[model samples]
Target: MIEDIYEYADPRFRNLTLPNTQLERLYDGCRWAEGPVWFNDGGYLLWSDIPNQRILRWTPEQGVSVYRAASNFANGNTRDQQGRLVTCEHGTRRVTRTEPDGTITVLADAFDGKRLNSPNDVVVHRDGGVWFTDPTYGILSDYEGYQAEPEQAGRNVYRIDPHSGEVVCVADDFVQPNGLAFAPDGQTLYIADSARTHDPAAPHHIRAMEVVDGRWLGKSRVLAQIEPGIPDGLRVDVQGNIWTSAGDGIQCFDAQGTLLGKILLPEKVANLTFGGPRRNRLFITANTSLYLIHVAVAGAQYP
Candidate 1:
């Protein structure tokens, strides 16, 4: 008999349980949804609607509200070690940090005197440096932001040294690098290659690279090959499981690349973040609607 797709589970683990509850859609009617960041201090979740050029906030009481208009067509967002909001702006093609007082500080905008293509996703290192992926996806169309001429050669990942203010390319060879996340241990970096958008035959897979002496090394290995829809953004759980957004739902995979569980959703999930009072709530940006679910796992400490 053929294996049941929805009933399938990895053989290595068996505590999976499918929640009967449907995803609670918080708000809808967004042109395109991306970048989910959870702020525990404010008891709310924030995400970007790229085509709308706005960042939206959602709380249990207020439902949803506009956090900021003309958000530079922001893509991915995360909190730094100091709990400050770090964002990747497609319109500005730079990475910025939002201070506690609401001041915006540009972290990185150019490399070698040329503007970046578009900042995609970002993560902060323990040493205070910011790393992000720069791909041309945002500037290829007017849906997310105004189309602009390419300013860089190839899509690459860059690191901004907090102390020196120098931006360096850490990795360069990806066709269209998108979401990125460091493993809980900080020794591994996971990057989602959405290159299929440029090259139809290109494999859409999540690749893992080893970090050595502040540089990415070793052969890039395929962590997972997304089907139906490509992987956009993702986060790692405390237990080292990767929670990635796909067309079908949020897919979870073990550190060894074993598919563990999946949280099915009605719409295509763009990105997600773990937040809530206990940091166990998974806030998902599924197309226009935002959904939340309480999970047993906690988000990685550095995410």
Candidate 2:
């Protein structure tokens, strides 16, 4: 059972996980599950089935349902400050938002008149500015999106101004920026560089940068080095620890870069988030299924 999958590196990790709760399989039958976001008001979870070009919903009572069909090969989903749905599209190669009235608005698609490679993952700050990662995975193959040459010279992480609607490249030196999360205080930004998938010699680590005046101030320093697999997606706990998806399972690291522990799973996890009533439930998006586990800590973001 998944309850027995816990492996502890430091003794403090034992306190974060419980011994009696079993991992629950919420749903299955997805091509590649990613970007899990929970709606507390509606009591449901929304996630992307990237290859299927759709977004799916999982509720406690109704089971699995189609939230949005023909999602433009959406890859990531998050709620903005006003509770709007912000998404990164692989096929459309853009970032979009679903307004309160159900109208779809394109948040970003191009920079400097050059089309983006493909928007992969997205996050929204309290100030309503949206940050996302642009990579070529969507345009490199048809499995995720259409095959085409990259219009932009380099794949970068960009930030869109909430008021001006201006998109600016916050960081562009990474080989591939996959996952990102802000600290509880919103002073630090953590990003995962999983370039090893394309270049075996590249580093598979998460980096931390100080956020200054809505821009990255200095060069990022290594936060944690993941082995056996790369860090795909991550989220921060209230205590500022990072819970990242790994090839084997979920790895937990402290704010000071200490490996706390790992919540092992049977499959490769792509992304995860803390949900449930009090944000104590950890929802995991693995290769083909969605899994959930209860935790003592709550997610730092969201209600």
Give the alpha-carbon lDDT of every model.
0.83, 0.89
Q: What would the TM-score be for candidate 2 when compared with the true structure?
A: 0.97
- Local accuracy of candidate 1 as per-residue lDDT tens digits, 1-303: 113223235643234332443456778868888888888888988899988989999989888899999899998998888899999999898899999899999999999999999999998877777889999988898878679988898899998887898999988888888888888988889999988766779868899988776554456799998876888899998888898988788888888888876777889888988888877788888887888777766888774
Residue lDDT tens for model 2, 240-285: 9999999889999999899988999988999999999999999999
Candidate 1 residue pairs that clash:
none
TM-score of each: 0.93, 0.97
Q: How close is candidate 1 to the true structure, as a TM-score?
A: 0.93
Task: Give candidate 1 regions above 4 Å deviation.
Answer: 1-7, 11-21, 215-219
Worst 10 residues of 2 by lDDT: 211-220
